[model samples]
Target: MSSSIEDRLRDAMAARAQAVQDEGPPPPLPLPRRSFLVLHARWTAPIAVAAAIVTLVAGVAVAVRDGVPQRPVAVAPAAALTPPFYVAAIVTDHTVVSKTVTATTSTRAPLGVYDSRTGRRTAELPVLVDSQVAGLGDGRTFFLAGRERKDAPLRFHRITLTPDGKIGGMFALPRRDDLRTETLDALAASPDGLKLAYSVNTRKPGRKGEVRVLDVVAEKVRRWHTDRPGFVDEVTWAGNARTLVFSWQRVEQEIGRETRLLDTSAASRDLLSAKPVTGRTTFFAARPGGSSFLTQEGGGKGIPPLVEFSTTTGQPLRRRIMREWFSPQAFDSSGRVLLGIVRGGGLARLDGERLTLIEMPELPQGERVYLETVW
Candidate 1:
């Protein structure tokens, strides 16, 4: 390594040691290597140059059930019926999950549920010490996962909403002995909430290349071994419950990646189709609630806009370039509209061919709000 990089590394290590001395050994970082699960919203931020993205969008007034006027989330092509979604913003103080926090802010993660129809913060549900959240279809409840301590096995928890729309209860998901529990590399819940898919951290050499799909109702788990010499990166359920989409990268071979669209209906299971890519190795982040997924182009070099492609065939469908690469967060219940947030820009909605302005909550001075979304 160069002298400058070496110095930077040395300084970072020293700082880390100092932090450990100050705080007790921290919990295993809950790094869901780009969680794209159904209604999955990240409370964490990405490492990138803090480029300010100025979002300017025209608007229209639409009325919701309350008859309240709200700025439109998206302006569809003429007569296009856009799907609606509920925006969930998980506001927190922790910048990095792996590190310890000073515990100055609210102890619980505050979840703000916004009505897309009215563009209003309908309810705020306070959850466990969660850094991310996945929207459950019930429109109120959600899933929370955590690693409370350094050696704490990664586990899933459910956050059920009360009749009044408050965070009524939180419960741990039953633990499985067959699965590795140290890290949660990725997590995806089936649309129907019957199946849960997740992979432990396998980025390390010699770790088995695999992923597990849990049958929530049956309480049984099925394992999918990625082609040997390769590991799974991300997983998502296609529009239908029986189909699954995942990222598989070869570690020992050509050193490239491909998106696997697998159908899990047959006894032996069938690899329906592997989405083909042209230029470079890119992992696909499937948008929740649909067959469409997002992938970065430009060969993993400069930042690339998340491109939307069809799962049946790896064909580009739709995507709106932001001031830069816009992260795809959620899709509407109908899998029609896509909601994305930028590093510095506020929320954006992808309609027919344009990005319409959505609700941007004003943050306290010097405060930043992190958002997660679901339909």
Candidate 2:
């Protein structure tokens, strides 16, 4: 062979070797089973490629640049995420009586603690008048709001639970005279228990809706007001305590409902300045210390009820809900158990795709209603 031709062939081989080095090694392969080589020879290559593909698809990672040190993604192990064992339920009843043109009304809400596994009421607190309740991420600390009657000032209290799921203590929050007249439509506590965020709208004509974030320890508050006469509901916090997700609806305009994300870290006080996360959502619930949240779609007969969504993009993360499950209210720490209300005034737990109706005892007669539940 000519010297020039030999040199060209050698250079071509060297270029091909460098190209292979640039494309890093293949993804780690799955461990092989006990099948010996006697089973099949030709199938080995195809099976190995299939295993590599599975590894690549299942593993999501960020691209690593040369000499850049990236922190390893910390994924909470399934074993560490424990299912909630105790549940705090708010039970309420309203009655009205009319006697020969004279009418009277009464309202009462009783906070009850139940064994989540057995659906048995372990303890009950005395009735709280016209009350609303929200739980801190710790699963034991809760906040309760109550009022004497319609158009009356509201009072706030902090509730603690014993290890056995009984009421441990109840203490009143430092009163702010400005908050007495405002009605709390929705409330959520930060995962770290450092702050409380709530939406208050009186619904009086020409009044705008407002959202407030109060620093629990500091007792300082920051307010955000809507541009128009609107109200916010279903207020929930993302795992990163700074972001809040809620549904906004303007009463003056016919713009329907919009799910919005508000960053409390920002200085702006205008609520509308926050961006919309999803389109016209009626309800959504966030998992404690989780990066995802659950949102539901309306249905009549054949539609799936719940969809897990990424809190960052408001995009559906997974779709594995059964047709029977509906109105998801809370999620266990590991997000494996979804607690929701089902037909006939009972609670249901959705573990994976299987739905189990909790065996609950009958409540005391006299028109009972289940308002809310949390763990």
Candidate 3:
């Protein structure tokens, strides 16, 4: 081989090796205004490209260059009440297993603990299947929801993580039949972490399912059942552990119309009443520190144009069209700290009225990502 050709090959390998390293440390790269504009067309966004992120609420912007997030500019210090802690799930593409090099370092964990204000990745936790994990919030223990195998009954284990992201310890709760093999939304916990609410299948062929709550203090389980045979939507704790809310839909004769994946209808019911709250929606998510909730536009699958609901009442607050798709992910107790992912993809923090996108450098093709609030 010619010496010139050999030199060229060596340089190419060095550049490829350098690309995988984390950029300059400390404050994260902010999304810029120009880059933010591109995400407005997220539905048609090209995979494997750096996303130009915009966070107007916090006055920050991040620019993605060569599939790398670069040129971060801080608009101002984040709000005082904003959530400082959160857990993030990075969904890499399935096909990349053989294409990229796997690192044994801390930043590459599928599950990561991040500081919202500083954009610092504080700890790297176990790399469990995204479907096998149920977020219990930052300071509280998380549920490693899983089963031994496809034939085995579902298992829910409460595991605590230390500051360094090591599993401090884990305990298995009594196995339940209702927990799905991979659906984390099937389980929920109250803000106080004193109670858990879940929906399980019924043995009788003609009966509706049961929504059960386990009180940690008393170590007693309480059960609530629907009048007819139906499926429960999501079981959410309405702040403070004082009220538990859920939605149920009766089984329809037509399986094609009522399929779980396609169903978007919602009928919210609180523990206080048999009737669902009039005009309740499945998109509403309970705020972390309180019973308040936040919702995106419409139901099922579509672009969420705006976020709605009063911070105080958790009721419909206002609706305004968004230039880009922003989906609410998590909120802290103060009801002040809010996290939302762009409708197209990636993470963004809601600053008062403006939004700042968190630039993710390494996204595998066709990756699926979700955020867990860490307050």
Candidate 4:
């Protein structure tokens, strides 16, 4: 009976080996030495036969196990996207000469890294004056949009800081001459640090304003223009990366100001192609995947309520915490945490229902608090 089973198994293995030409190659296996087997044929013969059957069975079991598909392992949800550190605003005091007033105004604004929990500054960057700042969700990478004059072309600098907020390195992005002629009202960096969405608000009479997305590494640009005369600013990207949440207001009146959603994947070039999310939003941020929006509505009295609303149904989900003079800046990667300005004071963080006030670096005397900060 054993001899018959061994013969059958050998024949089956030969047939199976022939059928395996479709797969690349079989795994290399050791062959038994014939001389040792012959010397101990009586005792070793039966043992070798049993061992051969066991080896074949084990190989078959292994092949069956590897061939079967496995159910995917369930991954745990990610922790809250609140970053511990932030790249505060670039501090610069500029003087405005108008017909009504001419005075040298100076205010020392916070221009470095700061702790989100304790509200203390962690590190400082060199003076990058007259520049706007944007950040990737990672908390260390940032981009500075700078120009020499109002009409000068804008140059983008990519900055990376160490985990401790110390300067790592800096480099310039590809320069685009076309951006120089237009005014950059808003600039937002994608979470992946590969793309940028900016609004060009040209105050010209008839010409339309523009929204542009630049592929940083590829040096390619995609543009969408406003159909009518309106300004589109405060552009923020949904976690999806392709959806943008921006504030749009007509050039004639600010009454009908609306927060709208733009799908960059759309084929349309007109800015009006964007869908309306909410209206009367003082400042706004969108959650990842464009599923909801958080807006600051009503500020005539005390602190305006930071309300979260469903984008699909346009219904209020819930209201969040707010500090005095809290100006909604941007949302963290998870879209749950918010970073905002606290008037002439320090930074404000809203995580869930809890609001935390972070202290900025002390300003020198005679310096006003003009903060344009980022994470």
Estimate every model's Cα lDDT from 0 to 1.
0.54, 0.65, 0.51, 0.68
Give per-candidate clash totals. Answer: 0, 0, 16, 5
Worst lDDT run of 10 residues, candidate 2, spans 56-65
TM-scores for every predicted model: 0.53, 0.65, 0.53, 0.65
lDDT string, candidate 1, 1-375, tens digits: 466875675566555455443433222322334444332442222211111110111111122224454434543446334333353655545433436644435323365666555566656654322234565444555665555554545556666665444556877778643333334555676767777777544535755456667787777777656335666666777767766777766676656566666666646532323445433425444545566666655355445666777766756776545455555655554455566665564676665566666664555443445654554
Better of 1 and 2 by lDDT: 2
Model 2 residue 332 lDDT score: 60
Cα lDDT of model 3 by residue, 255-351, tens digit: 3111111001124433223433433343445666553455566554555555454433434655656666776655555455566677656677676
Q: Which wins on lDDT, candidate 2 or candidate 4?
A: 4
CA lDDT, candidate 3, residue 198: 66
Please say which candidate is ahead in TM-score: 1 or 3.
1
For 1-375, candidate 2 gives per-residue lDDT tens digits of 566875675565555544543544323334455574455454555455444444443332222235343343555544333233344544556556666554434343466767655667777755544456677634577777666566556566777888776788988777542555566777777777677788888647766688888787887778899668778866888778888887887787766577777888888989988877653344677777787778776444664557677777766677654666467776664456666777656777676666777655455455666646766
Using lDDT, rank the candidates from best to worst: 4, 2, 1, 3
Encode model 4's per-residue lDDT on 1-375: one tens digit a residue: 488886786677556655542333333344447985566466645456556555554444444445662333334434354576777654456677899987775554445777666656767665533455788755777887767676667678888877666778888887564555566778888777788888887757854678888888888889888678888767877666777778787777747577777888889988887887643577776665557767787545777777776655556788755656566777776566788876665677777556677655555443454556678
- Clashing residue pairs in candidate 2 are none
